[model samples]
Target: MNEQEFLASYDPRAYPAVAVTVDVVALTIREGALHLLLIRRGEPPFAGHWALPGGFVRPDEDLITGARRELAEETGLGGERLHRIHLEQLGSYGDPDRDPRMRIVSVAHLAFAPDLPDAAAGSDADEAGWLPVTALPGRQLAFDHARVIDDGVERARSKLEYTPLATRFLAPEFTITELRAVYETVWGQPLHAGNFHRKVLSVPGFVESTGASTERGGARGGPRAKLYRAGDARLLHPALLRPAREEAVR
Candidate 1:
């Protein structure tokens, strides 16, 4: 068939309806533990169940925009706080039976934000808050969201080894100990303090000193530590591979 003839014959309505959605796996450290943003569904198909904050993509919106809108809406975050968050596409999940309401293809986005205040529930969510990642094992999460969260956590853990993305989980100026705690919390294991300190400083452009020190000493009362901010480098040279990964490969 000619191009014009083929176009005329096409019928979009003949195909089964499918919906696209965007879910955000927002992570941060609270009380020295890693937490994920979750919402209680206020509507049907799993009402009252906790799930990652998300919504169906609007017809006029792109995937990233849709994800950002959902994030802001569910968390009620805006202005400088909203702009400070770092977001990136994690992956897409589409199982024919993933959603009972219909066939849904979810483009999941991962976000890292500094410690935020209690979330204000949005229109679609009855309640919104940060849930500790370690506590998710026994809880019920709606619509295959548990799996999505697992993937996002793994992505965050892996990304930290080779990227400066971890800094997103902290304030603009942070101490090395604070940064190290971020790694420990996300990785779910304790990292060697001395080794971590050396590795972080050895990596060129990983962090830049702020030339200012904390007003007080360490939490235990020692000389104050110097502060630093995220540097310009996008990737780490001589990547700091996780110790567990090294053991597995050996």
Candidate 2:
């Protein structure tokens, strides 16, 4: 068949390509607090609103590559350094009208960084900063982004209890105290220090000692602690579950 004939006979209705987009829930720590990256929309439908940093996936790129591209484009930093940013597929969101433009299937990713660079290099992100997740903005987020962020947070919280993902939020050779802080930050609760320490060590493959110690004690008043690194195990044999809140009497 000739090119013109093939073009005339093509039926998009019979073979539609679902548009794939990538959304990143980039999180970081700032001033001893857990924060999320928020971008201010510059265009319409929900212009001037806040949302997660992301964009449509390119045909030549993988889902993770696309997510990293979006992050780099909006953050202006690149290299294998970004490749180390612990990117994982959170879930897929494909509601018919989730996006006003067209049918867009987004594969959202969750990432944790010790720190983030500056604002978007040259995008419509009027502003980009780490906002305390506990105090997410009340403004309606653009394009169902609020739902995406919620899912990412839950994924982080659950992953930390059984997975070694918490290491992504820490520096190399960190102390147990620092690792526990990551868990407490995401879980939004206080963990018993002694119990937490014991439990973490008991979980084989969770961490390995480096035979090193922090140069100094905690900011407060404690002896210098030892350092450890993530181990070979990807999972915690005995996962840590957070304490459930008690119900109030009617």
Q: What are the per-residue Cα lDDT tens digits for candidate 1 across 1-250?
A: 9999999999999999999999999998899999888988899889989999899999999998898898888777777778778989999999999999999999999999886777778887788888899999877799999899989999999999889988998889999999999998898889899999999999999999999999999879999999999999899996777888857877
C-alpha lDDT values of all predictions: 0.90, 0.84
Which pairs, if any, clash in model 2? none
Question: Tens digits of per-residue lDDT for model 2 on 89-208?
Answer: 989999989988778899999988887776663466677766789788665688889899989988888888778888888887888988889888888888889988999999999899
List runs of model 1 lying over 4 Å from the truth. 1-9
RMSD of 2: 3.9
lDDT of model number 2: 0.84
- Candidate 2 is scored at a TM of 0.89
The weakest ten consecutive residues by lDDT in model 1 span 74-83
Per-residue lDDT value at 118 in model 2: 61
Give the CA lDDT, 0 to 100, for residue 249 in model 2.
Answer: 18
How many clashes show up per model? 0, 0
Colliding residue pairs in candidate 1: none
- Could you tell me the lDDT of residue 158 within candidate 2? 84
